[model samples]
Target chain A: MKTLFDKIWEKHVVESITNGPDVLYIDRQLIHEVTSPQAFAGLRKRGISVFRPQQVTATPDHNTPTLNQHLPIKEEASRKAVEALRENCAANNIMLFDLNTEYNGVVHIVGPELGLTQPGMTIVCGDSHTATHGAFGSIAFGIGTSEVEMALATQCLLQSKPKQMRITIDGNLGKGVTAKDVILYIIAQLTANGGTGYFVEYAGSAFRSMTMEERMTMCNMSIEMGARGGLIAPDETTFAYVKNRKFAPQGEEWSKKLLEWKLLFTDSNASFDKEYSFKAEDVKPFITYGTNPGMGIAIDGNIPVNEPNVKALEYMNFAAGEKLLGKPVDYVFIGSCTNGRIEDFRAAASIIKGRKKAENIFAYIVPGSKSVEKQAREEGLIEIFESAGFVFRQPGCSACLAMNEDKVPAGKYCVSTSNRNFEGRQGVGARTLLASPLTAAAAAVTGKITDPRELI
Target chain B: MQKLTILTSPCVPLNVESVDTDQIIPARFLKTTNREGFGKNLFRDWRYDSEDQPKSDFVLNSAKYSGQILVAGKNFGCGSSREHAAWAIADYGFRAVISPLFADIFKGNALNNGVLPIQVSENFVQTLFAEIEKNPKTEVTIDLPAQKITINSINLSEYFDINDYKKTCFINGYDDIDYLLSIKEKIEHYEVQKS
Candidate 1:
């Protein structure tokens, strides 16, 4: 009995050592500025080169300035990181997508949109959001910097395989529910550490019905819940999305790949170490009020009365049993590996269209990738955003980690579509309320946390 | 990597739950490549006031507490995958952190960076916190080879779990790269076979 995760993991196993971790071969590896420099340094210390430079792709995303991206990055530490990446990639013969390149964007977004992430491939990145690649039925996960060095030096990782978990969401999704809401609800129910020892497979009707971009959003936050990664079985919807992507296979190779991908689903008799079932009706447009993703509640619901909730509420200055429905929002940020796709933009832009951004709100509409930016412009999404007084900035992880100049001021509240709501995640003393793009859009227009369903 | 077979130190209790990596080392400090300087910015937001002055109420700044061990609330290191959190802790002179739960990536990062993340039971953690509250300078000993953490003042001892592979690395001060090099031939052989 082979589950989808089992099949993918087994096929990639290069050597299994007794009482030790499996030596798994990597099919593709993504490197970003923040994590790769130290790995390259370790390699130099050992007098070793990247084992398979062809399979490695380097990009500078985390440290790149969102605005004025064409000019030199101004922040001293941020500039050094980007420059080090440029120099290292050049010296190591690794392909790089630097700032201003059409291919330049967040590493997670650029990889799949360019077709580098494919089904049945074992993908790894130094960053945790690498799990986003699992939307295509691939076994993907994040690694530490030392593991990045290991992957570069050997094209293999000594990894202890994680146990399997199957999370099945059945029934139809209610109105205003998005892939983001479903995940937030799961994390809330499961808690941040719920999936710590498992690799989750999102299955059944709800996940099957999600668009590729939606699936990507769902998998992107898997790390937030402490899961090594999450994956979905690739079907026709996945194939269609991968068909003409820039790096996707062409001609006869496409047909051959499609046939193999179609067989990637879990067998009926396959057993998982643990299983969970949830109803799509139970999921609603959600928002996190506290410091962690797990401290989320429904749009109209009260915060849970618990010890963690008490601490989180104290930090957030929110009272338990007090409704979060009308809390004012100061900033609205829409971008990250979590919800920066074309679909996310469409959802936000549709809500913002024909209405101006609230005067009290500073809304930033950032696309995930340069490709996404181009598509948004061609589709006039950018025009709608700009006309509504929202700033449509160039693609980088702006205001997500606040690595650049676009930081929310201290003590301000931001309705962000990013993955994490950790304390001071947006900036020092800045509070983040993680929400779907639609929810953020709703807040942007109303200057408060209004349910997107009310606006829709 | 530092050999961590046995460590004895006082504990600084941070009772707040789910202390994430962002709280440990803020993202603004993650831009630099050098790992050593991170200690100064460890818990940058919490340790300092808006004016960049050290807050007297913060545990690290208090005269009553001084230790190489941090006894924290559950779910320590739960956010980003930045190893700088571990670097900050190690650089700040903490040899070990005892918690009821730890996020997986952060635990791995801590281990690789020579900061021991010792997972004890919730009751044990609460007891440690209470004991630390009673006496901030109470000493605790962690024996890595025996997988035991002993709170000397409380006369309590608990065993922790670590994989043999990691345990070997921890005791010998070997990093992942060191192990990879030791098994370089095996990696090369498998790569050739796969190709």
Candidate 2:
């Protein structure tokens, strides 16, 4: 009997170095402008082209401005990075979804929607959120520039097999709870470093009931909790989500892939290195008070008074044991690779449909991809958000990171739906309260930390 | 990559827990194409204020501390997989980082870039911090072949873990790309057989 991760990992192992990392053949390598430049430079210096160009995909997301697609980047270094990616991808024959392309978006979001991410595949990217693709039952994790260069030159990465951990949530989730809340709750319970050396497999009724997009949100934050990646077993939901996408298998190949994917589950008697169980009913719309994701609390809960988080609390201008309710929110950004899918916007719109954004709050909604942006436009999400006074931006990883111009001003508090609430992550001296889009919408409406359930 | 071997030096104790990569080097400074000259901006926000003045309170700015090893709190390098953090550490002249725990990606990045990440027990880390704070001149040594980290002031040491292959690479300055390229045919053969 083998765990789901062991099966996928073993299938991809070309050779194992004695007492060392295995040479793992990567099925897909997603590259972005920020981290791929040095790797491309390394390839150029070595006088080698990408070994398996067809298996690689490149995108310029980290530094691209959300508002302008056609105009040249205003920031000099950012323009240079995007241009470097273009030159490298073009010269190496690697496919690039450049700026303004239909697929140009966050690297993690573009892969799944385009069907480049598949079950039983080994994927690597230079961005930590590369873990987002594990929702499709793939072995995806972030790598450094050297490893990126190795993948480019050999289509393989030398990786050690991470220990397996199975986290089970048996009961049904309560109202107002989303995948973001579930993962946040899990991180709170397990602490940030609990998953440090393991790859987690999310199991049980709670995870099974989630849609592909929601599952992606769950896996996207796996890196936040120190896990290499998190994955769920592929089922009919996974198959349907991947069925007719651009790069998914077709006809006989689809049938063959379906059969292969059906066998991607862990055996009944398979044992994990560690196991933990939580009731789904225990989850609520959660939010982080400290700088780390693991310092989260339930929507109506108080900040823990006893944790070793004095520094994080000071950075956020919060006191231990203080209630976060009614905390003023100066900004509300409801998008990221974590929760930037159609369902996430639907959740946010469900709460913001008939209400006006608070005059004191500046709100933004950035779609994950060009297709997602177009679908939001078609489905009236953009109109609904605009009508409520929320500024809807074009696709890219906007505001979630401080790379581009959409930075949260210094000293302002933002209720963001992005991962990682580290100090100065959104901007220098910017305080981030990580939460779900519904909660962010509630904050946008009230200009304060209000539980989304109250608005509902 | 430079070959990482044994060295003894005084420690720079950050004393902060869960120091994320964003704090190590902010995202705004990551746009460069080359991997050189990141040392100046390492801990950019912490080392300098809004007006680019060095914060005298920061550890790196204090004249009392100078070392090639960064002995920090637990769970160091816990967020974001930017290899830039490792690059910054290596660029800032830290040959090794000793912490009670390390995040996965940062550990790999450090190893790849010739910066050693030494994972010690929680109690040992606490003792090391206490001993170093008591005397800033306290020296520490990491012996690669023996896999032992010692606090010279206390004359106490504990064995650390590093896989044989990585140790071999550290000793010989071997590149992972070279190893992977050596087996490219095996991988292509495996792909063909599977397809």
Candidate 3:
């Protein structure tokens, strides 16, 4: 009727009988080491087996060190969490992608690359960035431990459907701009909570121009603005990306599946609850000034100093008005499910090819997946990074949320590509400025905040 | 060990819109998995200044009202899937969070931690907000057994449909594991039959 999102949501809703919550069938349940322990424990304590083991997939990513897959985890708590996942998966008859396995990496990265994440599937995970799966035109969102248990026991979730919003970005992106910048710009235009009750569909000329990888990066960040998730209609770019993935349809079946996926878009007369549009040219590489993603501004813009409110000023540590340029930085972290892909690396490395690290800055470059790491290394991107004094770490969620030893010291200012600059997301007392990969790299090399376009 | 009983007082109105997870528990405190002491840091950044002093702007810092149940505006707990946010809310002494809407993940975490998340109509939410504005001491009652919430002398009867199994465990103060342990005899019988 409207789009696949509407169709799938309507079809899977078990019932709404009179006045009640709708029980929605979850088509896929992805788990990772960091959040699944308590969920698995809940299941065992209830004496319940996973209702649909085939629908659930587990991986060890967050706490797994990227440096060496063979080296045992150094942190005791991290090691314990990883081991617990292995043991839990074994006991529950669930599939696990432990470190050193071909399937190991960020759950978001692994799910799509393996073809395990497909179009029109409702995917749930214990991690918020689960919106990454929506790139394939699916309705995906994160669930908590109890919900994970509920999904495990029944393969269904009691959900109240979210409102729908379509954000259309038209025109062509200027040279040097990427999908990361587009989403950052959108967040800047709409405050962090702008899309609170809506599932956003990204459409128009700009979105259609994006490659599947680019679309994935854009959709991966839908949660930043409080959207339930983001999606792009399937096109040739989507078909091509899934064609050879590990789990996608094969041989003669692939062509037939492609034909069906082509129908995933909204009809010309489809309606959305709300609509907004922006020009691609207005988008620029952005960085956060306040504690949230919506508080970002273009790299070239001044930190707002003239706000009448004291809370805004105090939260951002900003004076009345100060240019962000040349502001000293203490750390630069470039990795997360959000921007850890090869394209992100290439965009960053291209800007830092001949650059030297700032005298006072500490920089770390962590890839999102082993596959991305291998690809970057094969292209000699590792050498370029090492030569620039950037630490090339293994594939895992590194300083994104500071789960392990990777943390910024208290009160230090950091420029990161990872989402959420909330107070101490990187570490207790560490002030974070969220930006795109290129912007983070530029800041790392300069030892100060600099616009990525200047480096280019 | 004694059973964990959360005796909630009449619901105290919060009346703020889009209360995100960051506002519940700032992202800085999410590093640890241990669900202890988060109540102090709950809304730490929003509730306090850099000098560890309380911010005058935050509602929690206000001297006008204080109680266990929180009545908030639309879209409460809108960011991050951090259980710490829920733990912080519960530990901070909030027994129920009433809003027009709640983020799916945040709602799940609240239920698991024994903090009830009540979804009400927008008109009711507005009425609650107005009442609280008129009198900060306004109170509402939430009777979990009856699955009903009463505010401003208006009774809003609603059913929170949890998993049938989870509902039993919660009412009995048993977690999933405790429920399973209690059924060990039956499970053992079934195992014997299979063997």
Candidate 4:
């Protein structure tokens, strides 16, 4: 009768207070530059050290400069944060993926790429997108800095267990609809607050058919709908993806681990607190038209007629019932923790192989990690991008939150493949339209909001 | 964390729905390791113009309304797990935020800090906004032990819920990690058993 989330959570729960949060042990802890400095300072103030330093992994991502990675970072605050991460990791003897290292990338992407994110593990990070690791059937979510310190000290956290939600998407996905579009469609249909108190498990055929990278992208944005995290049951697809990675178990140990992971699925008799089913056909090449991620519509669909829609239209400089067929866009960013994988680039490149980017659009193609960048270049994807007139930037969380120099200008429209479309997220007064890489590629070549299906 | 037993202040009403953390504290301001100095940057884009001048039309800049409690619309603090959002709110002199709903991470962050996030019924939230709109000086008191929020003008009272452990922390002005450390023996024992 227990759901997969419950089974995982129950296994991790060390001690449960009668009516309070359960103290759940963490297996893998991920750290990054932005939210970890205060935590380390707190440990120092208390004259304490990290409990299990080997369990922790740190990287410099949020504030790292995307361009000229080897050069001295220019911004004082950005440079300080990156420096602080290096100093802290070195002082503590913790594993750090320095900017020069091949392992360095967004913390979320680097975790799975290195095989550090195993199925049935409890992972925590200070970044909300930690849910991306939940794609491996792990109970993973974001934590505050204090919780970061607690996890650093105890390798555990006190968390109130969330209710279970099973969102089943069946049927076949239409052409040009990527995992990014599927998630955007779900968030929009569910609204921003729909999954407020649930740990969602994506089930059914559509999710099962997705590649590991696609599943990661789908789970990455679960937090946008207010879900604590999201997960998919482990299967052959999951096992096959985890094989032969850097930190994954080798040979005999792999078979033993796979045997255990095989039982990670939800039993047919298991029940969830809530369940929602959707037809994959209902999803299209989606794009957000407002300040929030939930304010999304299909690429060829009309904006909904509502007071909130009117307000969103006002903010986005769009009109109610207006079709966003050829809405002018100033920028197109194809990277973030959300869609900065090699598969994302392949999807975008497949659409823009021979077409030059629209003369008016400033487009960027950034890989999620150094290895992803290397793999893309090795496969000639960078040449495809350059030939299509797109600037291929170094890997980091560039233009996602505009913490670096890749900010979208004020009052400009950017069709981004990032998770969020919040007001001023890319820059002050910068309007973001969330979409898939294919849709972004189409918009980049057309200089306006165009559906990838039309070009496909 | 400071003791938050009781607080009475004129309500600052922000009626906009789904106010995300990015709008609460922009990412550019998140560079500092210290939680200090975020107050000035709270709602940085909304509160300031391109020239860094205070926007006269922004709610925080209005002199008529001043309070430590902000009565916001539904789904407040809806995106990002940046505790900087809570830091900015607390530093901006807000002692509490009352809304119909709050993002789970934001609620956790608020409670960990000294800020009390009160989840009231939608009707009560609407009433608070209406009362605040009708009279800018509408004062509301949150009694933590009693778990009641009273509107002075309307003579109305509503109760809210908070976890007992969190409530204990709020009333005693205790650090959260210290509480977890109090049960360190039990945690270690369990870890040993599992291994």
Best by TM-score: 2
Residues B88-164 of candidate 1: C-alpha lDDT, one tens digit per residue:
99999998999999888888888888898899999999989888888888999999999999989968999998888
Model 1 spans with C-alpha error above 4 angstroms: A305-308
TM-scores of the candidates in the order shown: 0.97, 0.99, 0.85, 0.98
What are the per-residue Cα lDDT tens digits for candidate 3 across B1-195?
112233445455666565667667765455444556889998786688779999987788888878887888777887678777887888888877888778767876886787777887788778777777777767776655556666645554444444444444456765443433344454445434522
Candidate achieving higher lDDT, 1 or 4? 4
DockQ for each of the predicted structures, in order?
A: 0.65, 0.92, 0.21, 0.75
TM-score of chain B of 1: 0.96
lDDT of 3 by residue, A115-220 (tens): 9888877899988889888888888888776677777777777676788889999999986677888998898788767777688899999999888778888998
Ranking by lDDT: 2, 4, 1, 3
lDDT of 3 at A118: 83
lDDT of 2 by residue, B21-66 (tens): 9999899999999999899999999999999999999999999999
Please provide, for model 4 over A1-456, each residue's C-alpha lDDT reduced to its tens digit, 9 standing for 90 to 100.
778888888998877876678888899999998888989998999998998899999989888888899998999999999999999999998999999678999999999999999999999999999999999999989988878988988787878888889999999998888899999999998999999888999999999999999999999999999998999998888888889999999999999999989889898999998999999998888999888888898999998766355666777898777888898899999999999999999988998898999999998778899999999999999999999888788889989999999999988999999999888999888899999999999999999999899888
Candidate 4 stretches with Cα past 4 Å from truth are A307-309
Q: Per-candidate RMSD vs. true structure?
A: 1.5, 0.8, 5.8, 1.1
User: TM-score of candidate 2 restricted to chain B?
Assistant: 0.98
**Under CAPRI classification, how is model 3 graded?**
incorrect
lDDT of each: 0.88, 0.92, 0.77, 0.90
The fnat of each candidate, in order, is 0.57, 0.93, 0.23, 0.65
